[model samples]
Target: MSLTHDATLRELPTEHGVLRYHEAGDPGAPPLLLLHGSGPGVTGWRNFGANLPLFAEHFRCLVLEFPGFGVSDPTDQHPMVAALPAVGRFLDALGLEQVDVIGNSMGGVVSTRFALAQPDRIRRMVTVGGMGRAIFSPSPGEGLNLLMEFTEAPSRERLIEWLNSMVFDRALVTEQMIEERWAQATEPSTLAAARRMYSRAALEGMAKAASTSPEPPYWAMLHQVRARTLITWGRDDRVSPLDMALVPMRTIPDAELHVLPNCGHWAMIEQKSAWEAAVLAFLTRKD
Candidate 1:
């Protein structure tokens, strides 16, 4: 069967819940796990669907829908907290001992955390923004603020504002895109989960807790990532901002950085060909 979005739709029951994913490419090919961001209406398909055909040509592409995103089963734990275990379970379910990864925003953070925790499971990784701290730029940058705003109150206007911030070229935010996102973003279960992650109260609570937590933040531990990593960013990313990539680029022992100009938070989608070229080269490189 040919690979297409609907044709690739699949689900696997895991200890966490029913894990929904899109699978393409030969089952015999090396697996490539694609993880999506934490935007209000985000899903695995929405984030990486367009890139699947190209990636599937070389590797088995599995776009995982993280828990609490409406596409996957809902969980009481924060989505980020639920994500790590979901990844492990999904891989275990598929009998994939190790695989390459491509993560966007929140997914990047999750992938980094997973690599640190299970050093042997990730052969290589690529992250499109959201892997580090804001050394110079303001915390919770423009795109995040808009995201929180939309999560706090669901409105077509707010969703539009957030979508516009995702790409450097506003033209990418089409009416159909807005409508699809709006429908999903407003779903009662999805919106509630989003609040747990992006509401002002949640952000404040997390900050206050992090202030007293004994553990150092993940960015401080980037030096420990064992996998070869490609840290891709958009020069115009308003969400995480370009400065955030500095720490990961400089710290990850086996890492390289690529920043595409005239792009924003969604580098993989906004600068599709260039991002794919960079990622494919890194993943397939032998040195």
Candidate 2:
């Protein structure tokens, strides 16, 4: 399969486990990594196929499925904590010394965690509805249990309902999209991972606050980040909430915020054209 084709899956070995990722864009272009959200059915291609080529114009986009998520097995490290090493190993394997990263939702949290830990590894970051785990910010769903309820007993209607809740424009939640997500969610491997993740989260006390903020100095560290950051969000987002966007706006000195109207959590999908333009412009900015 072609780079643009996700049906042809590829795998790369990391210290923890093998990551199933999709490759796209100009092989010679600067490496740009795209991380998918933490939704139960998310996969690199599912999350990014629409916009991969847009970025591919200027980047060698490596869309990766986080360990324990798409086609990857659960690792010893809490799935959340493995983002750093996963990306590290990915880069190492590809001979990419450093690269720019763009993450949404949980992917954003992981990107934030990775950037704080190894600032030098990241050139720039774009977090859309980024659910950074910094404890200072608001918790997930503003303390709602809706996502869990949906996941516990998922169906085409429930998936559609979840998307309707997630995207500001109900019309954007199409039947095909709903069915596709439902199919991905019900896949035995993916479903198993979700169950395991739910269990692990409960054990780690993350079942409720998957978006819990990181530890001390993390706030300070966010302030210290030298890489230019772009924070984007749907103004009406309930999944991660719009208020948390303020944390990065105020904390990251070099960051800028762009909130889209009539949009919800999935800005990249709901507001793809605008989101892509904003992301490309920010990542390409030299100043």
Candidate 3:
């Protein structure tokens, strides 16, 4: 039988508000906190939807809903850095001293920041297509504009086309995926929340942080992280290309990297078997 839905729904009262989380598998198993990317329809489940059942069998997986995403309460602040405190609060509320942290894209940036600020709280780190230095072909804002246009477009096909632009494989853009994303993106609060999040200053601030943070960019930080690390990427990812991950593989002494060929940005969804195998192998390593 599948795990009970209630078994996965959990909440933690933080200083900001009550954050919603989904926990699966044995409560006493080792802990893993999963963080999702930032996008028009991002949520923890959307990021790891395909890997949940597999991860549940081995680890106590907690999928976090970031502020303004999913069912979580919106924060007064705009930038993600402002929300790091809440992550710390969630960890404290759960009475967890340390946890394995896994994140993608924007969430990866937040995870890296949290680890840097509170290194003692992180046990192991795994980042898939995680953030790093700025890589702009046109402009960073162009990506946001494309998503916004397609998300607000009246025609469903156009929306799917725009969504598919982020991935290498068009077949992965199923109707169910588009409908699910549209439902979340068109929620009453999403526009207002996104407006706050992408104000010119907020975007500029994020750009600056990406370009000039004193701490090692994600790659540099990978070297300093005391915990064992695993890095995975989709070979055909359009958003954060695997071409950029090469330097990090050499820098991190204890890190292992896996690339899923023919997969797109959503490795968890497109090539789940390989992704799960890599993740489980890393987590179970006795070294």
Candidates in order have lDDT scores of: 0.93, 0.75, 0.72
User: Please, what is the TM-score per model?
Assistant: 0.99, 0.86, 0.85
- Cand. 1 TM to true fold: 0.99
What are the per-residue Cα lDDT tens digits for candidate 2 across 195-239? Answer: 554433453575335346555634456787767889999988877
Candidate 1 residue lDDT tens string, 1-287 = 66677899998987768999999999999999999999867888989999988999999999999999999999899888999999999999999999999999999999999999999999999999998999999998999999999888888999999999999999999988988888888888888889999999999999998999999989899999999999999999999999999999999999999999999999999999999999999999988
List the pairs of residues colliding in candidate 3: none
Best lDDT goes to which candidate? 1
Order by lDDT, highest first? 1, 2, 3
Error of 2 at 236 (Å): 1.4
Lowest lDDT 10-mer window, candidate 3?
133-142
lDDT of 3 by residue, 33-141 (tens): 9988876677887787567788888888888888876468876676365457778888888888999988887777788778777888888888787455434333443
Least well predicted 10-residue stretch by lDDT in candidate 2: 136-145
Q: Can you tell me which runs of candidate 2 are displaced by over 4 Å?
A: 1-3, 74-77, 132-138, 142-144, 196-204, 207-220
Q: State model 2's lDDT.
A: 0.75
